[model samples]
Target: MPPTPATAIAVDDLVVDRGGQPVLRSVSTRIAAGSVTGLLGPSGSGKTTFIRAVVGTQKVRSGTVEVLGHPAGSKPLRSRVAYVTQDASIYRDLSVKANVAYFAALYGRSRSEAMAAIERVGMGDHAHNLAGNLSGGQKTRTSLACALVIEPEVLVLDEPTVGLDPVIREELWDQFRALAKQGATLLVSSHVMDEADRCDRLLLLREGRFIADDTPADLRAATGTANLEAAFLHLIRELEKAN
Candidate 1:
């Protein structure tokens, strides 16, 4: 028999609320070690909230979320996990290199390490430019470099490629795949269905709940559709019919 696959992230019956309304309800899923998982949903479908829960930043109403065997928000998981939100987290006045180095310092990483990360994200050419002067995609790439400097075991990205040009978006996805190949578990969230085909595993969400969790090919096969987008719509219809 094959050995059991190692689990990098495990959520058991997780529930969360904000402003007295449920954001995630009894959501449970496991993300495998050394793989890329995509959480696809609409804007208000709890993708960001769910990503926050996995990163241990959001307050949970009840249930357990574990990362690498520790409870979510546990102190040990801090350095091992990295989160890149839609909003770039960088000092506008600082150069791109400076911004990445600042975050590296917080994680006890070296300047050289930061530079390597910057290069990996295709931000090397703009390293000396002030972050405020960079374009939207460039800023996002710099923020990604900061996260990469830590060499996190698990990287959670919220819509990292939403507004990027097709080339840049493809580049980011390539980097994500490379990270997973290097033994890092990555959870990338996006509302766009076109990006669904890039993931090894997909968790489709709607109205704070999962509509389907399967591979792109599997989802298509199950829905008897040749396109991932069509499969998503079929699943949504099925979910609505069930409800």
Candidate 2:
């Protein structure tokens, strides 16, 4: 019995609706500090909606989301939390270095901090290249560099590795683990099931509901599956039987 890890994020009975349709139903979970947590689900499974709630961007119909000891989206938490969406939130006309520097300036961070962030994301070689001229994966890395410039306590990323090649994806995951080791809590969402094992804990979602919340090993063991994708399918079948 070691000490329980401090909680970085807490969501209680969160419900969200969009276009008159319910997108999240009674979602609740706690994310431990300094850990990499994965939000895994298929597309249109409310993964994005739930992350939006955590980052204080989604309109919740009910419930609460607390981040870094403050209510999600609270002004005080603005600089402590960083979010990168599925689409790159970067200036295509600007060079990679310029984009990182611009975002760092917004957070009152120094240029050296921006450069460090670019290097962390393995985009230092392209730092002087225009973002518009880079590949999709490069653009994603540029967006990540901008987010990291703030040295946020909590990072929420949506499909950060979607377009990346195996080598780049592996490198990015290593960076994520390093960031967690340095006391940053990361909540990363991905539909790629193989990425599940890279996380310390996982929130398995489906159709606006959570199917499981546990470590990847526990999920695999509980479902008697060889891998996360099989485990996910097993859970879905069990859920169908229950319903």
Best candidate, TM-score-wise? 2
C-alpha lDDT of residue 147 in model 2: 95
| Candidate 2 C-alpha lDDT tens digits along 1-243 | 122349999988999999999999898898899999999999999998998999999999999898877889999999999999999999999999999999999999999999999998989899999999999989999999999899899999999999899998998999899999999999999999989899999999999999999999999999999999999999999999998
Report the C-alpha lDDT of model 1 over 181-216, residue by residue, as the tens digit. 999999999888888888999999888888888999
- Residue 8, model 2: lDDT of 93
Number of clashes recorded per candidate: 0, 0
- Residue 158 local lDDT, model 2: 97
Q: Model 2: how large is the Cα RMSD against the reference?
A: 2.4
Candidate 2 residues lying further than 4 Å off, grouped into runs, are 1-5
Q: What lDDT does each candidate get?
A: 0.90, 0.93
Overall local distance difference test of candidate 1: 0.90
Could you tell me which residue pairs clash in candidate 1?
A: none
By summed lDDT, the worst window of 10 consecutive residues in model 2 runs over: 1-10
